[model samples]
Target chain A: LAKTTQPISMDSYEGQEVNITCSHNNIATNDYITWYQQFPSQGPRFIIQGYKTKVTNEVASLFIPADRKSSTLSLPRVSLSDTAVYYCLVGAPHRYGGATNKLIFGTGTLLAVQP
Target chain B: DAGVTQSPTHLIKTRGQQVTLRCSPKSGHDTVSWYQQALGQGPQFIFQYYEEEERQRGNFPDRFSGHQFPNYSSELNVNALLLGDSALYLCASSASWSGPQHFGDGTRLSIL
Candidate 1:
């Protein structure tokens, strides 16, 4: 598993766009970048994932540079409900009979959305 | 339509005591993994279970053990618990080893 580093915290206002970047200098060829959102007292929820370039879903967009050393998760029109810790994970998707697909989480970026 | 479910949403045990936590995977999910999350920290992988066998585990010690049933339900057993073991235990279920995982609310264990 590639070690991921993210900001300890970030602040944004409602209706604004928030981007959290994660750095993984040792990313491998088969590594995939996945992001998760976690609220207080709840398990982290999958937000988006990408291997390279850009992948956008209804909730967020992931941008990966050609070097693949770092990735960014962009949340548009943020709301108060979006306040949570965002995690960046680097690993390969699970293959049958393969190593366990356990996600290694960092301290995560605590995104605080203001009014 | 039910997501992953865990029993005894919260538990309290004394040091050296044993505790058992149960989890029922999300519908159609065959793999279950357990994680330990300490306060103000990220979740740490404990182990993963597939096909009713222990597939892989993290750096946790044997004090942390688990079992996966044929029905895909799972249990985490902790013996000779220490105060350090107090944390939220999360159970995640995935359709395949590599697919997106769904998590349950978790069982909050407090070792007093």
Candidate 2:
């Protein structure tokens, strides 16, 4: 499993864009960078996932540089409801021949979206 | 469809007692995984079951064990529990081994 490092907390105002970066220096070639959003008392929701370059979804966007050692999760036009913890995970999508695809969440960055 | 569901939203147990928590996976999911979350910390993986067998596990002790039934529902059993075992036990269900997983509300276990 590739250990990830991210900010512990971040603060932003509503309607502003927020970007949280994660560092996974030991990322493997088969690993994918995934981000999840977790609200209080709720399970972590999948936000975006990408293997390389950029991938955009209805909720968020993931940008991975060519180096693959780090990635960033970008949330556009944030709202107070978007205030939650965001987790960054780096692992492969396969289950066999390596560690299980179990997600190991970090402390997460507590994003406080002010209104 | 109904998402993953766990039983006994909250529980209180004493040290040295055994406790069982139940989880019903999502409608189409066949794999179940358990995790333990302490306050202010991220969840730690306990184990995962696929095809009604224990597939993978974390560093947790043998006192923590799990079973997955044919229906894909699962049970997490803790024997001779200690006070430090108090935490939120989470159950997640996935369609395959590496796909996205849906989680239940989790059972908050408080050991006294």
Question: Best DockQ goes to which candidate?
Answer: 1
**Model 1 off-target regions past 4 Å?**
A96-100
DockQ of structure 1: 0.65
Report the lDDT tens digits of candidate 1 across residue range A1-115.
7999999999999999999999999999988998999998898888888999999999999999999999999999999999999999998767546434788889999999999
- lDDT, candidate 1, B1-112, per-residue tens: 9999999899999999999999999998999999999999999999999888898899998999999999999999999999999999999998774567778989999999
Per-candidate clashes come to 1, 0
DockQ of each: 0.65, 0.52
- Checking candidate 2 for backbone clashes, the offending pairs are none
Candidate 2: tens digits of C-alpha lDDT, residues B35-109: 998888888999999888898899899999999999999999999999999999999888774567778889999
Interface RMSD of each: 2.0, 2.8
Candidate 1 chain A weakest lDDT stretch, 10 residues: A92-101
- TM-score of candidate 1 against the unseen true structure: 0.96
Model 2: runs farther than 4 Å from truth? A97-100
True contacts kept of each: 0.61, 0.42
